[model samples]
Target chain A: MIDSRYKEMAEVGLAIRIKGLKKVYRLGQIGGTTLQEELKRRWEIWRGRDDPNTKIGQTARLTGETFMALNGINLEVRQGEALGIIGKNGAGKSTLLKILCQITAPTEGEIDINGRIASMLEVGIGFNGEMTGRENIYLSGAILGMTKAEIDRKMQDIIDFSEVEEFIDTPVKRYSSGMFVKLAFSVSAHLDSEILIMDEVLAVGDMDFQKKCLNKMREAANVQGRTVLYVSHNMNTIRRLCDRCLVLDEGKIIFDGDVDQAIALYMGIEDHLKTEYHFTEESRPYGRFSHKLSIERTVIEGVCDDPRIGQSYNNPSFGYGGYCLPKDSRQLLSNYGTIPEKIIRAVVESNDTRKKYIIDKIMRLVRMAEQAGQNSVVGIYRLSMKSGSDNSRESASLSVLRGLIDRGCTVLIYEPSLGGLCPVEGGVLVAEAEEFKSRAGIIAANRYDPCLEDVKERVFTRDFFMRD
Target chain B: MTRNTYYLDKNVHFKHISAERKWIDLRLGEVWRYRDLILLFTRRSFALTYKQTILGPIWLFLNPFLTSIMYSLVFGRIAGISTDGVPMLLFYLCSNAIWNYSSSCVTSNAHTFTSNSGLFGKVYFPRLTVPLSQVLAFVIRFSIQMSMVLVILIWYWAHGQIHPHIWALLVIPLSLVQLGLMGMGVGIIISSMTTKYRDLSILVGFGMQLWMYGTPVVYPLSQLPDGWIRSLSLLNPVTMPVELFRYAVLGTGTLQPVSLVWSWGFTLLALFLGIIVFNHVEKTFLDTV
Candidate 1:
C-alpha cells in the first residue's frame, strides 16, 4: 500500500502533501472522551435518544464545545522549497506545527510528509540544568533524533558554533541564559535532516545570533537542498526565510502564494482592524498622563494612600510576572531598540521603582516606630508573588526584602510555605503566628491575608482588589 | 521549474506516509529506527536518577538493601511470615528485587504522556521511546540489584541453607522479561487513561501498593488456602513471576502450570491493549494535557 502511494506521490514530485487537515479540540478534557462516558453516550444513542453533542451527518460526537483549530487546511510543498506559515494568535499556526511534528494528531484528514523532519518548535527542550553543557548537547541532540555517532562527529562544530567551549564542562545551570540558547540552537542547527521545521526559536537570542540562524537556515535550504517550514510573527524574517508563504486566519488558509503578497494580505487585515482605534492626545481621558499611567494611578489611589508608595500601584504587587509577561515584555522592548519611548521603558523599570518605594515606606514606618520607643522589627507576611502559591521567582516580596536588607533594617519573615528556614540572611523566620505578631513593629504584605486581621492596625499593604 | 520537470521525467519514487485514524497503528518500525534516541534517554535518566546525591549510584543497591532489612525486621521477626526454610533475607531480597522492577516500570510508565508532555510537545521521535527508555532504566537498576541477590544466593548455597534449581538460569531471565512486559502494558494503559481523566494517575500510587499485597511477594503461594483465595492469587500475572523466581532460586515454590500460562496470556493481551491505547492517545493528547 505504501509503495503504491509513494509511486503516486513521486509522479507529482511533492515533498509534503496535506489534504483536508482538520483538528477539533474539546474545550476542557484530553483524549476526547472517557470509556464510561462513551459507553453511556452509545447506550443513549442505541435507545434512540437525541444526543445534544451530536450534529447531523457527523460521525463523531463531542461531549463538550469544541474548537476547530485547523479546519480543512490543504497545502503541498515541492522538494527543497521554503514555506512560511503566518497567522495571528489562535489562527492555528501552532496547531499546524504540532500536526506536522506529529506531537499532536489531526482530528480529521491526513498529512503525508516525505523525508525525515527535525522540528525546533521551542528550543532548549529536554535540557537538564544539573547536567553539564556537553552532556546537554548530546541529550538535546539525541532528542532531535541525531544518533550518538552523529553527535560525536558534530560535537566540536556545535561547541565552536555556540562559543561555549570554555564552559562546556560546567553544569548548564551555571551557563548564562544567552549561552544556553546558543548551545540549544547550535545542536538543532547541526541536525542533518531533509526537512526542518522551526517556530519562533529565532525570536530568542541576540540579533547577531538570529542573523547567524537565518544564514544557517538559508544554507540548509539553498545550499544543501532541504525543505523548510518556518513560522514567525516577524514578517521581515518570514519574507527573508521563505519563498512562498501561507496566511492562516481563524484556522482557515486565507491566502497562499508569493511571500510578499501573503504578508501584505495579512498586514492589510491587521491594519484595517487596528485603524478603528486612534491613540491621539485628544482621545486621552486623563489629559497628559497617558491612559496606562492614569489607570495605574487610579488603581493605586483605590488601594494605597499614594501611587508612589506601591510596587506597580496598578496591581498592588509588581506588574505581571507569570510565565508570559516578563519574557514578552523583554521581547517587545528588544523590538523597539533605541527608540525614545517613555511608557514602554517605564513598564520595564516600574517594578524596580515600586520595590524601592515599598522599601522606603517600610523604612520610614520603622524609623517612626523607633523614635516612638517601639521595637522596629518589620515582619514580611509572605514570599510568594501571589497568594496560595509557593513560586517566588521574580516575587515582589523578594525585591522588597533585598531593598530592606540593603538599607540595613531589622526584618523577620513569616512564611509557612517556605517551611522553617529563612531564605534571606539577617532575617529570622518566625514559625509561630503569635511570635511574629509580638516581634513585628510593622508588617509588610503584598496582598492582605485575613490571618493578620487582628494585627491589621500594624499591617501595611496595597491590596484593594484582593485577587491575583 | 527545471527541477520539477527533471523529477517528473525521472519518475522518482517518493514515500507517502499519511496519518490515519486507525485505533492500533503500532508503528514498530518507526520505533526501531529511533532506537538510538531510546538508548540516549535511558542513559540520560540513569545519570539523572542520582545526579545530585552524594552517594550517587551506590543508592541503587542501598535502596533494596534497606528495603530487605526493613522487611526482615517487620515480616520475619514481628509478623512471623514463613520463608519456607530459605533464609528470610534472601527470600525477601529476591522477591523485592523482582517486584520493585515490575512495579517501578508500571508506576513510571503511568506518567509517560503527562510527565514528558514538555518534550513531546516540541518534537517527533517515536512516542514509544519514552516508555521504552523508562523500562530499560528499570532493567538496568534491576540488574544491579540482581548482582546483590546473586551474592546472597551464593552465600546461602555455601552454607547449605538453600539449593537453587539449575533451571534458575533460564527462569530468571524469562521471569524478568515477563515482569517487564506486564509492567509496561499496565503502565501504558494507565498513562493513556491519565491523559484524559487524572483520577487514575492519583489512584496509581495506592493501587500499586494494593497490587503488591495481592501478589505473592512476601508469602509463598503454597501458604494460601487452596480455594478462592489461591485461585484469585493464581490469576494475578505478578504471582507467576514471584512464584517462578522463588521456585528457581529456593527450589521450593507453588508453581501452577495453568496459572503460568494464564499469566503469559494476560501479559500479551494487556501489552496489545496498551499499544493501541498509547497510539490513540499519543496522536492528540496535547489537546487535553
Candidate 2:
C-alpha cells in the first residue's frame, strides 16, 4: 500500500538528468577531513593528537590517511539507454554503482536518478543460506526491494529460469555454492526494478545463464525502457551492451563520449589518457600492509635512469633495495644471462652508467647503516623494485627482512597479512600498531601511519608520497 | 501502478542517479522496505538449522529442557548458583531462552557482511534485513523454547514451585527491541570490519562462545562478583533482556535498574554507529571483499 503511494509521489514523464556525478572514497580510514590528507600530512608536523576517527575500544588504528577511489565525475543516461562504465580495478566503476544504488554516498558530487534502482553488483546477494531454494527467491526479491505480492506473482518465472525447482523446498545450505548463485541470480533478474545497475554479476552461473543475463539486460533496456549502468572488465560486454560509455582511471573520468573512445581510454590507448605513466607505485599505497615497505632509490647505473630507455632491452635489472627484484625483472635477468656479456654491458652502458651507479649508491647506504655502530635496527623500507604492481613477487623486502634477521636485530615485518611468518618456523604476528611500535627498538617503515607518532622518534621512514 | 518517478520524461534523453536521506534513515527505510525479505530470511533460517535432523523444530524445545536440567544438576545440586528461591529449572530456563535468543541474534548477525559478501557485492537491498530476519528466526526458536519453559512452569505451578504474573507479557516487545538493536548493532559493526580484515570474523565466531559464558545463561546473575565484572555484564545489552525475562517468570531477580538503562543506551549507541559505518562501507566494500 505504502509503496504505491511512494510510486505515485514520483514525478511523471521526467527523463533521467545526471549531472556533476562525483564519488570520492576515503581509502583507508572512515573520517578523513580533507581532500589532500597525504600531501598536508607531509608538510605539517603536529604530534600527539588522537586520530578522531578511532572509536573508544578500537585499538591500533591510524588517522588522517586516505585515498580517493572516485573523483568528481559527470554522466547522463536517457531512460532506456544502456551505459557502460569501463575501467581497470580501482577505477571507481563499482563505486559509481554503489553511489547510484544509494548503497554509499559521494563525498562531493550530485546525481539525479530517474526512477527506482536495483543493482546486481554480484550474484545471489541477500540470499539466506539456511533457507531452501524456494524461500531464498522470495527473500532475494524482497531484498531487491520488491513486495511479497510481486515476488509471489513472479515466483514460477524465477523457478523455471533457475531450473532449481527440483530442490526448491530443500535447504539452500545443502545446495552447492554454484546452485545457490544460479537461484539467487534468477530471482533478481525476474523481479521488477526500474533501473538495473549490474557489476560483473553475469560472470557467475553457467554459460547458459550468462547468455540469459545478456538477453535479459537487452530486453530490460529495449522493451521495458529501463535505464541501465553496467561495470565489467569484459571488453565484449562493454561493446555489446553500452550505447554510451564512461572510462575512469585513478578516480577521474578520462573519456565520456563514444563507446569506442571510452574503451580506448580504458585500455590506455588514447593519447590523451596516455600523457605520462602517471600511475607510479608512488600515487597510492597497496593493501593493508603498505606500511611495511618503502623505496629508497632507483638506479640504472652506467646508463641513464630511464625505464623507457630499458623497455626495448632483452634483459635489465633495475637496481633495487640491496635485496631482490621483481619476477619479470628476474625473468629478464635469467634470460639476459644467456645473452653475450658484451651485449649486457652495452645495454648497461647505453643508460649512461646509470645501473652501476645506482648499485654503488645503494651498497653505500647498506654499509653506512652497518657502520653507524648503534645496534640500531636498520629498517629496510620494502625493497622498492617497480611501481603500480601489488604482487611485488621478487620483493626486496623479503631479502632485507632475512638479512636483518640474520644480523640478529629483532626484525618485525608489517606487510601484507601473511598466512605464515617468513624464514622462522615459529614467529609472532605483530598486528597491533602499538605492539609493532613498542617491540621494535628502531622502526623501518616503507609507509607511515599517524598512529606511530610516539615511536616515530626512533623510526626510519622513506615515505615521500605514501603511494605503493 | 503509478507511473510517477522522481525525474522521468518521455521526451528526455537520459536519467541521473541521486540519493537523499541521511545514512541512518536510508538504512532504516531499507530495513522496512525489505520486511518481507526478513520474513523469508527468518523462515529459511529456521528450516535450514533443522534440516535432515529427525527432531527438527522439536529440538528447539528440547535444547532448553536439556539445558535447564543440566543447570539444575550443576548449579542447583552441585555448585549451588543462587536462583533467588525460584525453582532452579524455571530460573535457568527463563534466563537460558532469552540468552539463546540474544546470542543467536548476535552470532548469526555478526557475520552479516562476511557471510553474505557474495550477495552484498552483487545486489542492492537493505543489508539490515539479513540481521533482522535472523532475529525473527531466533524468535521462532524462542517460541518453541518458550513452550517448553511453559510446560515446566505448569508442572511447577501444580506443585507450587512458583507463581505467574501479568508482567510476563512484556517479554514479547522487550525481546524484539533487545534483539533488534543488539543484533543490528553488533551485526553491522562486524559486517563493516569483515569486508577488509577477516581476522575479526574468525575471532567473532569463537568470541560468541566466550561471551555466552560471561552471560548468565546456565546460572543466575547474582552468583558473579560485585565490582566491574557485574558492571561489565550490564554492558552486554543481552544482559537486561535475560534478567528481565527471569524477573517476569520467577517474579524475583537481581534485574538491576541500571541494567535496563545500560542496555537501552548501549543499544542506541551501537546501532547508530553500526548504521553509519555500514553505510560508509557498502559503497566500496565490493573492491575490498
User: Considering every candidate listed, which one attains the maximal TM-score?
Assistant: 1
- B1-289: candidate 2 lDDT, tens digit per residue: 0011222344321223343334543436446656777787777676667777998877777787888788799878898767778887788788778877777777777678767776665556666677777777777777777887887788887887776655676676675676667777887788787776666667877888888887777766787788899888877777767767776776765667777888788888888888778766766566566
Candidate 1 deviant stretches above 4 angstroms: A28-63, A273-468, B1-19
Chain A TM-score values, per prediction: 0.56, 0.50
Model 2 lDDT at residue A55? 53
lDDT of 1 by residue, A1-468 (tens): 555555666577677888898888775433325555655666777899855345566544444568999899899888788899887779999889888877777767776666677889988988999889998998899888888899999999999988889999999999887788899899999998778899877654654676788889988888998999998876656777899999999999999999978866765453311111111111233332211110010000111233233233345453332212132222222222211111100111122234565456555544543454333322222333332233333345556555655676534333212321232222332222223333222223222222333332222211101101
Which pairs clash (backbone N, Cα, C closer than 3 Å) in model 1? Answer: A105-B283
DockQ of candidate 2 is 0.21
**TM-score (0 to 1) of chain B for each candidate:** 0.93, 0.85
Q: What is the C-alpha lDDT of each candidate?
A: 0.68, 0.58
Q: Compose the digit string of candidate 1's lDDT tens values, residues B1-289.
A: 0000012223342333345555656777668867888888899899888988999999988989899989999988899998888899888998898889999999999999989988888887778898888888898899998898898889889999998888676878888888888899999999998887777888999999999999988888887888999999999988988888888888878888899999999999988999888887887777777
